[model samples]
Target: MLRFCPLSRIDGQKTFVIMERKGDKGNGKQTQKRIAPPQYDEAFKAGAIRMVTEQGRPSTEVAKELGICIDTLRSWLKAAGVQAGQADRQNRDSRRTRELEAEVRALRKQQAEKDEVIDVLKKSVGILSRP
Candidate 1:
């Protein structure tokens, strides 16, 4: 006879299940109990994804709060078509582009001022030569 016990919790202790096999004590055969991975429902998974995607929380933080591994959370995000660290990279690129544009504008302004000065000097020389 095989007996399976449901998960139970007692006094703040962890939850676990018990399984027993009868009529196998005298046979000297050992049975190993296999522990399965924990399964999360769809709602739980969606919530975790929302925390990282909508709320803008880091994956590490979400994973830690949900008692799961960081990699696992990342994979879920990946499946949902969200790339980790993409936002940070885009922000950096945009900032650099803005800086470059500002520098170019400043250089053009300085060139224009230099050209104006040269034009004034040329006109003064022409007037002196004409006299």
Candidate 2:
């Protein structure tokens, strides 16, 4: 699970910035990390997509045989306007994950608001007798 932190407020204005928690160095500086791009050329990508589109091979099997990630293979196929059974399923799963994450964030914010209300009520009811 990726943990996201809210950005610090500057000048009393809230700004939104989303960053991945993965590969964090934990020393106050956050830097993005990237892997070396694969050496697959245009012809190679076309050939890989052909293996699935024309050969009717399953994307999973084709990716495994080609030593590439299923998502990468599917992306290449999609960009080439090739539709595979896995593409739809992958899109739905990606959308669902995003929806769930958004829901979690909304729920957390609501819970925080309720906590603030409860604290205010407790203070008004003399739960803490301040000097």
Candidate 3:
């Protein structure tokens, strides 16, 4: 005998529901906490739309990546004042260029560290091999 329940109102506002098993005794144990309902946000929706359209990611995948549901992604796409398949390509291109530049910088830094290590090893080898 499972029962669906609603939140209790306290001070004119709803509070979280705590459910107890039907066959359980009134021993103040075996309680399950209710998860809060989802709330809508405009910015989240816009960002989801942007990720889907601009980043060329699917809505379902983007929703999962963003920790939101597919329905939530749809709602956001509706709210973002943009279509699902329309993204600013120039913006994405520029962003990709920046990302590539940053990656190159990181690789250059790593190469410099490796070069320093090689120089030290070379100096050590020369000293050890000298007459």
Candidate 4:
């Protein structure tokens, strides 16, 4: 016989299912209690996947932080169509893009400063040549 115990809440959100089973242990009868995997809501699964996919956090790190197995996190990511190395690749690309943009901004600022000095010199020349 199998029976399901009342759902227990952990962290005020996660729900765990406990199962009770009755079996004959050769002598007469014995009861065994087993724990089923916790059931996560859609929001929890999406947040976990977002940590790996958009936040660029490692699945192992995210799993450790969330107190879950790494394999579980990876499975969630896989179901979301995210590859293991895709986050790292995206992070690297974004970092490089930011660096390049900063460099371009710096170069433009330098050019503007040079142009201002040239403008000042041209004004001084016009005044000196005027009378």
TM-scores, one per candidate: 0.43, 0.39, 0.39, 0.53
| lDDT per residue as tens, model 3, 1-131 | 33446676544444455565667555756545565656546676667777777676667678788787777677667666755444444446666888999999999999999999999999999999999
The lDDT of model 2 is 0.72
How does each model score on lDDT?
A: 0.72, 0.72, 0.69, 0.75
Global Cα RMSD, each model: 7.7, 26.7, 11.3, 6.4
Question: Considering lDDT, which of the candidate structures 2 and 3 is the better prediction for this target?
Answer: 2
Clashing pairs in 1: none
Tell me the tens digit of each residue's lDDT in model 1 across 28-122. Answer: 65444434456677888889888876766667778899998877777777888877576335545666888999999999999999999999999
Instruction: State residue 2's C-alpha deviation in candidate 3, in Å.
Output: 13
Among these predictions, the greatest lDDT belongs to 4
Model 3 stretches with alpha carbons more than 4 Å out: 1-15, 18-32, 81-131
Using TM-score as the measure, name the better of candidate 3 and candidate 4. Answer: 4
How big is the positional error of residue 57 in model 1, measured in Å on the Cα after superposition?
A: 1.1
- How far in Å is the alpha carbon of 106 misplaced in model 4? 2.9
Better of 1 and 2 by TM-score: 1
Question: Model 3: what TM-score?
Answer: 0.39
Tell me the tens digit of each residue's lDDT in model 4 across 9-35: 564543434344545235454444445
